[model samples]
Structure formats: C-alpha cells, structure tokens
Target: MVDIIGHLGMGLIWLAIVSWLAYDGKTALGFVALGAPFSLLPDIDLWLSKAFQTVNHHGVVHTIVFVAAASIVIGAILAKWVVPRFDGDYLVPPAGSSYVYAIGAVFVGGLSHLFADMLSAPDIAPQVEPFWPFVETKIVTVDVFYYNDPVVNWGLFLSGLALAGVIWWQADDDDSAVAA
Candidate 1:
C-alpha cells in the first residue's frame, strides 16, 4: 500500500508512457487527464469497507476483474456523455474507437495503481490478490519500499513529472518540425 502520492505518481508515469506510445500529441494529454482519476479507484475499498463489511482495503476490489468491470461502465459513460462534450481539440476519441480508447485509459490507470500496490503494499497493508477469481493466492510482493517512505513516494512523483515533461517536449519538437 503505497501512499496516495506514490499511487498517483505511478499512474502518471505509466499513463504518460502509454499515451506517448499510443496517441499523438494532440490527444495524449487528454487521455492522461481522463485516466488519472482511475489510478485511485482501487483505494475506494478503503471507504467502501466502512459501509460494507465484505469490502476490505486491498481485498477483492483490488483485483483485475474489478478494474475491468469498472472500466467498462466508465468507458461507456465517457463515450456516450463525456467525449461528445469535448471538441476535436480536446478529448475527442478517434471515430468508431471511442469505447476502446476510453476503456483502455480507465483500465490502464487502475492497473498502474495495482502494480504499485503489488510492489509496496505488503510492507504495511495486507497482501493484494490482483488476479482474484482466477487465482486465489496473493501475488508475491516486492516489498522494497515502505508505505510511507517519503523518498520513494516523492521520487516516483518527480520521475513521473520529468518523464511527462520529456514526452511533451519531444512531441512539441516533432510538431514544430512537421510545421517547418
């Protein structure tokens, strides 16, 4: 269970890389903006556990199945409502591909959170069963960093920012060259 900052940092880093590889400059930032929130989605179990006894932090909700199901619902909303509100200049998904793009963004963001927790959660939190229904056993955790390690948390955040900056800069340069 990495801190919120670490989870967000991991999301940014993972999404930035995914956006850069999968989208052009015009759409990459939008995807990042859209998906970033889902990175914290799994932690909702923290609050849900209070209302529902069955829900526990780092429990079933942390699984890939949960993420996938949530992604589908979120993706539908985005495709039907959110994406249409934005013009082509904004988060507009490619024609005929809105669901794919939206779902992928949400799924990837949740995945980033899961991966980070898997690497750090067992240090303080209960072990996460990411595979869940398919595999009841807890996945092996790396346990390299403590949950509240400021250095690790901040390092991930800063590294993510740096990577995003580099990707943006390179994209801008490429655009300039294209214009030239």
Candidate 2:
C-alpha cells in the first residue's frame, strides 16, 4: 500500500468521521477535515535524503518517533495558529478556537496514517531513533506488503469514484425534479 493509497482509504474514513461530526455535533466541518491530509505529509521526507532509505522503505520518516513528533508539531501549528488565522473571526463562539478540534482531528489522522503504514510497510520501516532519547536500537522486519498496495488502493480509488458518481447522479435527479 503506497502512502497515498493508505491515506486515501484513511481519507475516506476521515471524511465519514468529519461528516458525522458536522451533522451530529454541530462542530466545524473544516476543522475535522483538516487532519485527514496532514497525515500523509510526513512521507515528504523521502525526497530529502537517500540515507533515509531502507531495505523496504525510506527510513526515518516512517518510524514512530518521527510520526509522534510530526503529529504534535504540525498539529499544534495548524490547530493553534494557522486555522485561526485562516478563519479570521469567523469561528462560532464557545468553540472559542477551532484549534481544539483541528489538533484532535490531526492527531486522529496521524494515528491512522501510522497504523496504515505499519500494516503494509515492506518491513518494519526502520526506527533509526527507536527511543529517540532513551534507546537507539534500529528495528527491522520482513513484512513484504508495501505501505500502499496498488490492488487495494486502486480498488478503493475506484470505489470512491463510483460512490461519487452515484451521489452526483442522485443529486442531479433531485435537481431535475425540483426544476420540473
């Protein structure tokens, strides 16, 4: 499963979660949606260094330490600062800061991304800094599955496309009836 495919599946799940939050909790849909994509951004580190590559992966970025630090730093910035600035004073009161939800949502997205990567990663994507400050044992494994499996990814992509088509078709029918 490529990172993109895993994130796509995760994105579908995230979309459902956000939509439910929007419909049921009266929460800001934008905040809930924020976390879904951020989850995939950490992999960008691969483009930075060949030293990061492993037998089955480009290391460093895929490790738990990396995931944790990234989720917190990025999540905080987006939740506490970027979102508020982006919205200006448009936030509904009492929610005070949409940052709360944004951070929480990003946490969920990051966690989901980690889990997805762990499941399909070719080997245990090496943990270069296993314990960061505590232990430095490099971990390895033989989990042959790619983080993004084309079969599953394409299946999901196609399914999502089909679902979108159905949704649009139904919406068009409704509009036609209304116009009539």
Candidate 3:
C-alpha cells in the first residue's frame, strides 16, 4: 500500500480540484481537512491485522462495503450540519448534489488509497480485494513501483501542493479584482 503522505496527497488533491471547480480555495481547504483522513481510513486494516491477526492489511476495509457505510454516515453529517452552517455567500451546491459530493469525496478518498496501493508493489501488501464479499478477488495487480518509493510519493505530494497554490493564487486575484 502507499504510505500516509501519498494517500494524503491524493485525497487533498481531489478535494482541491473539486473546491476549485465547485466552490473556492477556502471551502476546498476545509474539505481537505476532512478528506485527508478519509483517504487513510482504509489503512485501518493494518491495525486490525496486527491486533486480531485475522483480517489482513488490504482485506475487508478496502472493499466497497466499508466505503459505502463510512460515506453514508459522514455524508449525512456534512449535509445535516456542516454545509448549512458555513458562512459563505457563494451559492452552496443544491442539497442533493452537495450531499452526493460530500459522500462521494469520502468514498473517493478511500478508493484513492486503494488505487495508490494497486499502482505500486503487489507483493509487499498483497492485492486489495476492492469488490470483496461478492467477487472475492483482487482487482488490481501491477508493478508500477515499490510501495515506499520516495520519488513517486513525494512527486505526488508536490503536485498536490502546486495545485493548491494555484487555487489560492487565483482566489487572491479574484479578491483583488473585486476590491478594485
């Protein structure tokens, strides 16, 4: 599986892109806080593997089931409380679309973790069972790089940082334009 930083980069990058498109830098930044952890949530299997010695690192939590449940719970909270209370003047996404995106972000975060793992070494962590329970097979197995490859991980992190920088810069420009 990818390391913490790599997963975080992917999650935050996803949020940044969404925020840039659908909201703004401020909003995306807030979502980044939420999205980063959700990205690593799938790795909870690591603790489970070590503690119980039953489920493996890339086992149950990597599947669609866990993502679905977590997304529903988290999305509901975002819809019910967080989005409504935000003090922004820009139009909030319609409740249904925002609800879907709120849930989708969490789900995508988890899926990003899985895809990152899939992109790298399969032998180290074994392939993840993304469609477990029903399919019972590892869907991705490729030799992109070592799981802990610093170059790939850091590159991803930097790319995400750059994207966020652009978003911030653009927002600042917009603010200045409005003031003028």
Candidate 4:
C-alpha cells in the first residue's frame, strides 16, 4: 500500500545499514542496482492480478515464507554464481564482501516492501493476510498513514537521501584511511 517513493526509501535505508554493517566502509550507493528494484517486487502482484486475476493486492507474495524463500534463493545465487561470475571483471571486481552484501541487500529490500504494505492503511479492507496460504491471519493492520499522503512518502524518500549522503561521506573517509 505504501507508495513507490516510501518503499524505495525504506529499501535504501536498509541497504545502507546492511552494507555498512556487513562490509565495513562500503558505499551504500553501490547496492542500488540490486536493492532498489527488489524493494518494489512485492507489488508485482498488483500488475499480475490486473492481467491474469490470479494474484491479490496483499496476497501470497506478502508472506514470511515467500520472503524467506526469496532470501535463500537470492543468497545462494550471490554466494554461488553471480559473485563468482562477476569477480575479476571490474576494476578488480567488487570486493568479496559484495557477495555477502548483495544477499542481505536483496532480502532486506524485498522485505521492506512487504513491511510497508502491511502497515499501510488499506483503501477498503481492514487487514491483509500476510500469512495467506498457511494461516490466513491478518496482521499489522495499524494505519500509520494513507498511502498517498505526501508527508510520509516524501519524508521517507528525503530521509533516505540524507542517510545515503552520510554513507558516501563515511566511505570516502574509509577509502582515505586505506590509501594512507
């Protein structure tokens, strides 16, 4: 239910923290290629349902099982294939730490999308069944703000930009230290 701006912002914020913690001094900007898109992935159902009618707005893709499965698959691909394939292709390839960063980045990005939709105020329905196929229990129905609200959407987006700036500044310092 969260707008694209808010969802993307949440992903960027998590990408910053995950990269910084997992790969010290890494620039969060580098993760946007992988993370930003995944952050909007859960909403794919919106488009699909419009076409085929099999999916729902807040449906199967919102579940913990779906998120966990995606994380595991993405992690495996990063750890086993993509990282290895890309190694030595770049200016020295990305650091080995990138493999680890990518796994966390994609997972966090995708999960953030679900989190936003869960907490967002629905247009009509009261709640979404995140555990749809398994439990049919609707949760996190707390309405923080209407999805179209400018403050929440723009605020999250701007906040992400500020945090990204901080990450870039820190990374420059780290690079300088390494050079020294």
Candidate 5:
C-alpha cells in the first residue's frame, strides 16, 4: 500500500543487508540491480486486476506463494538467459551459484515489498494476507504511516540509498586492505 518509492526503498534496504551478509562488492551491486525490479512485482496485480476479474490489488498476489513461484520463474530466466549475457564483472554469481543467488535475490525483493505493504496497506488499500491459504486471515497492519506519506516514503528511500552506500564503501575498504 505504500507508494512505489517506499516499496523500492524497502527493497533496497533489505537487499543491501542481504548482500552485505552474503556477497562481496561487485556481486552485491549486481544483486541489487537485478533484484530491485522485483520489488514492484507484486503491484503487477494492479494491472492484472484490470484484465482478470479474480485478481485484485493486495489480494492473493500479495501472498508468499505468489512471491515464491514468481521468484523461481524469474530467477531461472535471469540465471539462464540474462546473467549469461553480462560480463563476469557484472553480477558474477559464485561458481555454480547463479540459480540460488538469483532466486534468493528475487525472493528478498518480493518479501520486502510485501512487508512494506503489510505495514501501511490497510489504511487505504485492502488488507494484505501475506500468508494466504495457510493462514486465512489478514495480518494486522502496523499503521505506522499512510500509503502516500511523503516523509515516510522519502525517508525510507533515502535511508536505503545511504545504507547501500555505506555497505559499498565498507566493501571497497576491505578490498583495498586485502590488496595492500
């Protein structure tokens, strides 16, 4: 329910943390670049609802199941087709690790979007049922901010960028120290 900027901010923040924990500098940057688009993936339901009566924003598409399935499919495409086209310097997944890395990145991006929506969706949009079938109830929204709150949205976006910059800077310093 948060705006695109908020969702993207959350995605970047989550991916930055994941990248720092699991990857080195260039790889982390690549992961963020590749996965950030998926942060807006759930919102595809907005368009889908226009075409299909059963689909709706903040409905089944917001569930974990949808995220998982979409991740696998998107990851496979990225691993088999997209990544191969890029040079080793770009998104170089560790040897034989492309599939896992791609899928995990996609999942993280999607989950971040879901989490942001869960925090603010009920205030304006429909309640998000993130667990869906397994848990047939809407998760209680935190209501910390409104969907279109500029301060919160911009704050998250800028915070995410700053955090990512810090992580990248740290990684560069580490690489330099090692090279010394």
Candidate 6:
C-alpha cells in the first residue's frame, strides 16, 4: 500500500476509539477528525530516506521504541511549553510514565501505520517482525493481502472522506446557527 493509504486505514480505526471517548455526537466526531492525522504521523519518518541506519537505524521511526520516544518528547513539549504559554494546566506526564491507556492509544495508532506498510511491502530486505523482541524474528514472505488492492484502498478512502464531510457539515450548521 502507498504510505498515505496505509495511514488512512489506521486513521479510520483510530477514529472508532476516539469516538468512544466523546460525550456527544459532535465532540465524538471532532475527536476522530483530530486524531486521524496524529495516528498517521509516525510514518512521516518514511519521508526521511529509503535506507535504514542503529537501533533507530532499522527505520527507527516505525519501530515501537522510536514512536514511544517521539511521543514522550511531543507530549512533554505540549504539556510544558505549549500548555503553560496558553495558560492551560500541564496535562501529559512530564517524565515518562509506565505505558498507560493513553500511551497504548498512541501505540496502537502508530503500530497500525507500520503494519499497513509492512503487510503491503514487496521488498523487505531488512524484514520486519510485526511482534518484535517477543518474536525477535522476521517473516520471509508477504502476508495474505495484496500491496495495492483497489477495493481496500477505496473502501478506506471513501469512508474517511464521507466521515469528514459529515463532521464538516455539522460544524458549518452550528456556525450558521450561532451567526443567526
């Protein structure tokens, strides 16, 4: 699958989770809209280069370790710098905490992105272990899914766009009512 397509798959899945956290329809949908992009960001490392270099060398960005580290850094910045500057309270843990539900949310979102790419990739010169360390081994061939299946890609793409449109329409209506 193309990187964007892979992200879209993960984004839709993440939306389901975010929706569950909301109190109302609009909030639930807004959470989903906000989360879709974050869920896909771990794969931004792919834009760095084709070659892998260290622990992070194995396309470090996609690895659980790398994502966790980056998330901690990001969470810290958001909690420390951004929040205080905006007169909000520190929200995320300043120092890393044991992997909690929130951390798991991030992990699932990021790991899904990696899985999307791995399952669809033809060349795994440095093969990936979907369950690393615990598995500590690489799989030899591609999995059951095709790399760029039209049906799967279109299904996910359409779903995301449709959901986004619904969310936007609701927002626009709310805005119009407020204006009136």
lDDT of 1 by residue, 135-170 (tens): 888746677789899998998888877876776676
The order by descending TM-score is 5, 1, 4, 3, 6, 2
lDDT, each prediction: 0.82, 0.52, 0.71, 0.68, 0.84, 0.52
Model 2 weakest 10-residue run by lDDT: 86-95
lDDT of 2 by residue, 1-180 (tens): 245865655654654455454422223344434655765755666665556443234355555666666767776777666666545323221245554556566666655555555455544355233233455543533354665467766765465445434434544554468579
lDDT tens digits, residue span 11-91, model 4: 777777676665444434456445767888777777888898777767777676776677777766765755455443221
lDDT of 5 by residue, 29-137 (tens): 7677778889889999999988998888888889899999999999998988776654463345555578888898899999999999988987868888898889888
Clashing pairs for model 3 are none
| Model 6 accuracy (lDDT, Cα) | 0.52
- lDDT-better candidate, 2 vs 3: 3
Which portions of model 5 show Cα errors greater than 4 Å? Answer: 174-180
Error of 6 at 3 (Å): 3.7
- Residue 55: error of model 4 in Å? 1.1
lDDT of 3 at 158: 82
Ranking by lDDT: 5, 1, 3, 4, 2, 6
What is the alpha-carbon RMSD of candidate 4 to the true structure? 3.3
Model 3's TM-score against the true structure: 0.79
TM-score against truth, every candidate: 0.90, 0.56, 0.79, 0.80, 0.91, 0.58
Q: In model 6, which regions exceed 4 Å deviation?
A: 21-24, 50-58, 78-108, 123-126, 139-142, 162-180
Local distance difference test, candidate 1: 0.82
